[model samples]
Target chain A: MGIRQVANTEAPALTAAVDVRDLWMAYRPDEWVLKGVNLRVPKGQLWVVMGPSGAGKTTLMKVLAGLLPFQRGTVEVMGFRLRGDLTPPSRRVVGYIPQQLGLVRGLTALENVLLGSLARHGGLGPTLGFFPRSEVTRAREYLEMLGLGDKAETRVFQLSGGERQRVAIARTLMQDPKLILADEFVSDLDLPRAARILETIRGLVRERGLTLVMNLHEIQLVQELADHVVVLKDGKIVYHGPAGTLEWSSFRALVEAEDGRTGVAGW
Target chain B: MAEPGSLAGKGRDVNLRRWQGLSGALALLAALGWVLGRMGFFEPGRLTGGLVNFGRFAAELFPPDLSVLPVVLGALIETVEMAFAGTFLGFLLSFPLGVLGTRTLFPRPVVLAVRLVVAVTRTVPSLLWAVIMVIVVGLGPLAGTLALAVYTVGYLAKLYAEILEGVDPEVIEAVRGLGARRHHLVRYVLWPESANTVLSQLLFMLEYNIRSSTVLGLVGAGGIGFYMQVYISTLAYSRLATVLLAVLVVVVVMDVLSAWARRHYLLDT
Candidate 1:
C-alpha cells in the first residue's frame, strides 16, 4: 500500500506513460495464462520485468505493445486506452524489439531498417524502393550509432544474432515511440553484447525520456539498469517497486518458492 | 498387461499377413499379363495395320518441301507467344487467389472452397481446354492462348498457395510487430521471404506451359502442333519433319532460358 502511494504520487510528476490494470489473457479458454496481472510505467524511466520461463513476462510485454489482447484488463498507453478495436492507433506509439529479433533474412540491413518508415509513411513517399534522403539518413544514423553503418548493404542472414538484435532495436527506435517494449531481446547475446543492449535502453530511457519496459531472465540486470523492477510468477505480480527498495534475497526466495508451485501453461 | 501385449503382437502379425496377401495378388496380376503376352494373345495387331497404312502414307509425303517452312514458322511463333502470354497472365492472377487459398490466413470453409475450386480447375488439361475454348472463340491462336492461360492459372494458383504455406512465419511476426497493415505485410515481408521460391516454381511452370502450348494447337488453336497436323493430313511427311525440328529447337531454347533464369535468380542467398 505504501509502495502504491509512492508510485501513484510519483506517477504524475514522473511520466505515467503506461498503465496496465488486472490484465488477463488465455489463448485456450478455462486455462488462464495471465491472471490479473498489473504494472505501471512512468515516462522517461527504465523498468525491468524479470521472471523465469512461463512467468508471463513476454505475454505482459505483448499486451503492452498492443500486439495481443487482454480479456479482463484495461491498458492505457500515453493516456490512450488500448481496448476494443482501437489497436492500430494504439500500436503506433508502442515500439517493440521482440525476443526472437524478427529480422527479415531476404533484405539487407538498410532495406530492413528502411521498412520501419513504411508503416507510418505508407506508399506516398516512393513508388520505387528508394526511400527519401532524410529517412535514409535517419536509418543510417541509427545504424551508425549501433556500429552497423558499414554493414548497411549486408544481408540480414549473414549477421550474428547480437547484430540482428541491434538491427531490431534500430527498427523499433526508428518509430520514435513514446514507449518501448523489448521482450527478452538480449537473451541470446554474449555478456558484452548484452551489456550494450542494456546500456542503449538505459540511455533511451534517461536521455530521450522514453518509457522502457523490458522482460528479462537475468535478475542482476534489474539492479544494474532498472529504475523499477516488476517480478512476476505464474502470471501474477510478485513484486513491484523501486529496484533499490526490494531485498535481493527475499525476491530470490519468492522465485525459488514458485518452482514448487503448480506451473502456468499458455504463452 | 501381459494379455494386452500378447493381443497387440497378434494384431501386428495379422496386419503383416494382410499386407503380404496384397503384394502377392499384385505379383500374380503381373505374371498373368506376362504369360498372356508370351502366348501371342497380346500381339501388335493394331500396330501391324497402322504400320501398313503409314508405309503407304510415307511414300507419298516425300520429296521434302521447303515452301511450307514459312507457314510453319509463323504458326510456331504464334504458339510461343501463346505460351508466354498465358504464363504471364496466370502468374499475375495467382498471387491474390493464392492468398485466399492459404489455410493459415483464411477460415477453414474459405480455404476448403478455394482448394476445391482450384483442384477442379487443374483437372481440365490444356488440350481439353483448347477444344472447349475453340467452341467459344472459333479455332485460332486466341483460343490456344486463352486455354493455356486457364491451365497456367490452375497450376500457378495451387503451387502458389503451397509455397505461401511454407513461408517462415517469423518474418511475418516481425512485420506484424511493426504494426504493419495487411497490404504492407503481404507486400514487403511475405513476398520477399518467398519470392525466390516462387520465382523458381514460376520458371518450371513456364517450361511446362510451353510444352502444353504445342498440344493446345492440336484442336485448331495455333502453333507448331497445327503445322504438324496440317503436313501430316496433306501427306507432307518431309514438311512434318521440318515442323517437328522447328518445335524441338524452340523447346530446347525455352528450356535453356528457364534453367538459366532458375540458376541466376532463384538459387541464391
Candidate 2:
C-alpha cells in the first residue's frame, strides 16, 4: 500500500481540488436530502451556496467535503476520492469546519492551529504539553494572520465567540488545503463580526487562490466574498449564476416561504 | 405568531397537566402499597417485639475491645488497597473498550462485539466474581482484588459508553476539521472533555469497591471480611465493635474524598 501510494503521488494530476457529479443523499428512504447535486470547483475559486433551511445546503458541503456519505454520488477533492459511491476517509486535501465549529476547548489557539497541519502531512507532533519550535512558530503565524497573535497561547474555551470563529478559520488554513468547506460559520456571529469573518475568509481565498465552497445564510456575504452563487430549495438548484445577479428580495422570499418548515436558513 | 385560539388551547393544556399530575401521584402511592403488601411488610410488625433482645445485642457491641485496634487497622488498609487496585484495573481496561463500544468511534459490528463481552461480565454480581476468584486463587486478598477489578471494568464500560455518546460532537468536528487521527482525537479532545465526568465516576466506584471488597471476604476472597465473619461466628462482640468502628471510619473518609473531588472537578467554580 505504501509503495503504490508513493508511486501514485509522483504524478499530482491524479487529484482534483473539488469534483462532484450526480450526488444524491437521503438520510431517510422516503425522501432525498440532496437530489442529484452536480458541482465542480477547480482550485482557487470561491463558491458560496445559498438556500433556506432543509434545502440540503449544508448536506451538499458535507457530501463534497467527504463528511457525509451520499447514497449515490461521486466526490473527488484535491485528487482524492472522498466518496465515489462509497465513504472513505478523504480528509487528505480538504479542510472542513462544520456550523458548530468543533474546536477543542482544552487546547490553546496555537496548539489547535498546529494540530491542523500535523493531521495532513503525518508526524508525531505532540504527546503532552511539550511541542517543537518550528510547528509552534507556524501556529503563531496563522493566528497572527487572523488578527489573534496576542491570543495565540490562550485556551480556546476562554475566547469570545468571534475569537473562536477566527481561530477556527485559522486552524483550517493550517492544513494549507487547496479547498476549504465552511458550513454556515458566520451564523453565530453578530453582523459586524460576521463581516470581519467574511473579510478574513476572503483574504485567505485571495492569498492562497484556493477554492472555498461555503454554505451561508447571508446572501449579502455571498455578494461580498463569492465569485459564484448557487441557491438550492427542496434539494434542487433554483438559481445558479454570478453573485452580481443576487438581490435581497429573492433571497428573502426563499426565507419567508420556508419559515414554518425550519427555524433558520443558516445551517 | 400563534393566534388567540392557541392561547385558549394552552388553557386546556394546563387543565390536562393538572389532571395528569394528580393521577400520577395517586398511582405512585398505590404501587408502593401494593409492593409492600406483596413483601409481607405488615406481618413482621404484628409479630412479638424483641426490644429486650435488641438492647442486649446493642450492649454487647458497645464497650468494645480496644485492644485489637492494630489488627483492625491492618484489615482496613487491605480493604483500601483492594478498592484502589480494583478501580485502577477497571479504569485502565475499560478506557479502550469504552472508546471501541462508542458508535461514534468504531464501526457497528466492532461496537456490538465488545458490547456482548461487557454484557456477559456485567450480568454477574461482584460477590460472585469474588467467589470464582477465591476458587482459583484460594482464600486471599488477591481474590477480592480480581473480583472488584472485573466488576469495575463491567460497570465503567457501560457508563463510559453513555458518557462518550453524550460528549459534545461539536468539539470532535473541530479536531476532525484539522484532520486529527483517531488517537489524536482521543488524546486531545476525548480525554480532556470526558475526564471530569469519568473522574467523578471513578471516585464513586472506588468508594463502592472498598465496601464491596469487605463483603466479598466473607466467602474466602480475602480482606477485612474474614475478621468480620470471625467476629460474627465466634460472638466476639468486643472485637466486632473494633472492626465495625474501623470500617465506619474508612467509609466516612472515602465519602468525604469523593465529595471533595466532585466539588473540585464538576462544579469548577
Q: What do the candidate models score in CA lDDT, each in turn? A: 0.77, 0.78
- Stretches of candidate 1 above 4 Å error? A1-11, A84-86, A123-130, A241-253, A256-267, B2-69, B103-117, B232-238
Going through the candidates in the order shown, the clash numbers are 1, 7
What is the C-alpha lDDT profile of model 2 across B1-269, one tens digit per residue?
44547987788888989999999999999999999888776676433456667778889998989898898788889888988998899899888888889887789999999888998999999999999999888888898998999999898988898788777887775576566677777877887778778788888899998888888778988788888999999999888988888888899989998898788766331
Cα lDDT tens digits, model 2, A1-267, are 101111234334333466677778888895898877776665677888888889898888777766666678676676666543332345655788889887777677887777776564444546454557876788788888778999987888788999999888888887777788999988998787898888878887888777788898777777887877777788876666677677879667655674323222221
| DockQ (CA atoms), all models | 0.39, 0.47
Best by DockQ: 2
Q: How close to the true structure is residue B184 of candidate 1, measured as C-alpha lDDT?
A: 69
Residue lDDT tens for model 1, A165-235? 87887888887787888888999987777887788768866877788888876666767788888778888
Score chain B of candidate 1 by TM-score.
Answer: 0.79
Worst 10 residues of 2 chain B by lDDT: B42-51
Model 1 chain B poorest 10 in a row by lDDT = B57-66
Interface RMSD, every prediction, one decimal place: 2.1, 2.3
- Candidate no. 2 TM-score: 0.87
